[model samples]
Target: MKRALLATTLCALPMAAAAEGELNLYVWSDSIDPALIAKFEAEAGVKVNVDGYNSNEDLLTKLQAGASGYDIVTPSQHFLKIMADQGLLEDIDAHALAAFQQVDPKWRGQWWDEANDYSIPLAYGTAGFTVNRNHYKGPVDSWKVLFEPEADLQGKIAMLSYPDEIIGAAQLYLGVPFCSEDPAEMKRVYDLLAAQKPFVAAYTSDNIENRIAGGEVAAHFWWDGNSMKIRFNDNAPIEYAMPKEGLVGWLDSMVVPKGAPNVENAKKFIDFMSRIENATAQYNFYGHSAPVAIDTATAKYTAENAPELFPTVKVEFSRSCSPAAQDLVTKVWTQLLQ
Candidate 1:
């Protein structure tokens, strides 16, 4: 009987360890500050075990493959829809999440996942080039710099490696709809990106900061958050701008995975994160624009200080592409990168 009791205690130890405090989160590497984790843990009494991913596809692949350890995840708005449709996400109970009402109405029923049923928007930003005021004498408000490279920028410019962003930029330049579900429209966008590929310095998803800061490349298409990060860290003379034809943008969200272990806690965590104070801190720390409701201090900060930051509209203008279009875009991007 004594031995059986000891065995029972041992069995309960791991459960206790898992239960007393632990929320596994998978997000972009180096995106969130360690302090944010500590604060959330201290506030909610849960240890956050975070893992980071470099790409949305990687996150989706793992979730789709039935890897079920995470309590929370951050993926772009489109990926959130995909995950929700695949039954990989929990239907976010608005009642359980009081802070969700704090989310802006404009972002609430976005066409991608209308009614804010699937996830909560965390941050928003656009993809564009940061021109070096010191060197770039020409007008800098357009996607034309990279698509139609000038004599000076030839071979010295960089473009994103992602199909959505690169192709979307071309579509925007041509005044065509972006994130098109129509395969033919997508193909046209892909061909345009591929045509511009030869002039690209390298198909890159990283180091736009280093390239821009070091002057290794005069300009490159980069996320506004990443561009802001460069500006914050180096305080460079560089600038982040929306393309004159308008910029390609993205909205990222926090979601509860289908099989998350600590869902009540996940909802609590989401509530804590949704507050404008926390969101502003995240934005200031990481330099990515944070999703803020109207009339909040963070929204005021953005308007007063960083007015160029804007909401992403492609997900609304277009249906975010069907799987067929995604595959075709991927194939074309792969070929162009080769």
Candidate 2:
């Protein structure tokens, strides 16, 4: 009987492995709700592998370096344009997605994917500063606070490491266009960042919530979603502000890579995520607003109580920079790091 049982266990091992399908998802850290993922796995009989990236540039670099086996990726709108231009994305057949119809029309047919062929909008928010009100006892209502930090706040400010965000914020502070390409304007932006470098506690995008919650820094450049997450979770005295200059808007989308190993599974996963219930769950979990309209009492409360989560000022979404401009920005970023 023991020998028969051993043979049966050995036979079942391969069968169990065969029954498990795999989907590789590359997304921002803590962006997806684990509960929704588990539900998808249970329904599809698939094992989901999640990989995280700190910024859109990180994702672009990995894919450009020929990283493969990534079935799905979440890229901001600007990076989506670059990836689509490079032919690195697979066409998302709208007909194949049952939940595609559920997506808000406002998010579709945007400049990034004009035809709406390669990506689906996931979440949208603005970039701003998260301030520790306990330490800073001022109005805290302008880009000057970050661009030209007060002496006391020196060496206590954390800015995002992302080029587009940091550089664009500087441009806005200078009253120039966010995507300015002229050498003089670009130089001004670079100089601004160089000047602020000494005051910055750290240039980071990951773990910013923890850093802010722990009071490691008094001010940080962060997304509204993450700011909300830290505020609610830690109950810290953190406050999110949209400077009088304006807010930088961003939209993250889901797309399948060119050579995804599990294309069908990726589509299925996208469809699953598009469902209203799942979308609401993700919004509540990640503290970012999804394109899908959800009307729960919690959603209403969030909208009514937390106005900072939604930016009211002019919102500019960054677009793909020209190759020359991108190279210049990259060079400036390298200098800032050094």
Candidate 3:
């Protein structure tokens, strides 16, 4: 009976019979601007509902525990593989979508969804540190400033409480390979972070922009796009670093869950978002690079003044590690936090 119902829904997906409804998007906090959501609702006559998750693990845990009613989710590129393997993702046949062709050539056939069968890429950016130039007048070009700060910078740094990107940053700074199954390699990363804990003012992901802009910390871990918004929009004297040691790259994508409440509306939302006007507005609001190119003429912002969006060094995308490798990362992070 369940199989038959899913098949019926899949058959109606391409038809207009299932267009008007709600689209439930489980995405990162502050992502998918509400104005854009309203714009899509106006165009398609479909109401949209959005929710935010703390991390990729949070998304996985909710779905794994039999939670339902989510039509779409935004998972980082690496977690895409894990969710797909566990059968949490619906096969949307994304390549069939008309706007799929408009996806930038570089973003297509990516490691996460090479065949484009299940996910649509939205935003891509690097995770790095942001520094208040007023607080630190020295060079901001490397992770050295973050981990091995000047004497004055001690006790003036902050970090995200979670290990998702921060652990990757630590690994990058120490020149250690990601997902190292070897305990020794993982220990190096833990040691580096543990040593820097004294200098870290706080380890909280909440209200990072305010903390950085309000002169609470000299340096803090943050994404390039959010940092750009704080610097340009809020007039914060902050520089998002393109560290010489490199940075962690991520692409947040839209993927349907296995038992979504509004699958058709989810696809409609994806296509609508892929359109030029909507994409440009989202980019201007979020300040992140997109897998789909927006209409530059309609764009209100660019990477010209925001050097953070345009990196000079290499960006290594995170990949799903073996269970053992994942355990190493988890243990290292847990011990450091404790």
Give the number of the best model, judged by lDDT: 3
lDDT (0 to 1) per candidate: 0.70, 0.80, 0.84
Query: By descending lDDT, how would the candidates be arranged?
Result: 3, 2, 1
TM-score of decoy 3: 0.92
Lowest summed lDDT across 10 adjacent residues in model 3 is found at: 1-10
Residue range 248-279, candidate 1, lDDT tens digits: 66788889899788888888878877776777
Model 2, residue pairs in steric clash: none
lDDT of 3: 0.84
**Which residue pairs show backbone clashes in model 1?**
141-244, 142-244
Q: What is the lDDT of residue 323 in candidate 3?
A: 94
TM-score for each of the candidates: 0.85, 0.90, 0.92
> What tens digits encode model 3's per-residue C-alpha lDDT throughout 158-183?
99988878888888888888878989
Q: Which order, best to worst by TM-score?
A: 3, 2, 1
Reference-based lDDT, residue 24, model 1? 73
After superposition, which runs of candidate 1 have C-alpha atoms over 4 Å from their true positions?
1-19, 179-187, 293-301, 310-319
Please tell me which model should have the higher TM-score, number 2 or number 3.
3
Candidate 2: tens digits of C-alpha lDDT, residues 140-205:
678889889988678989987668788777777888775666878888888888999999999887
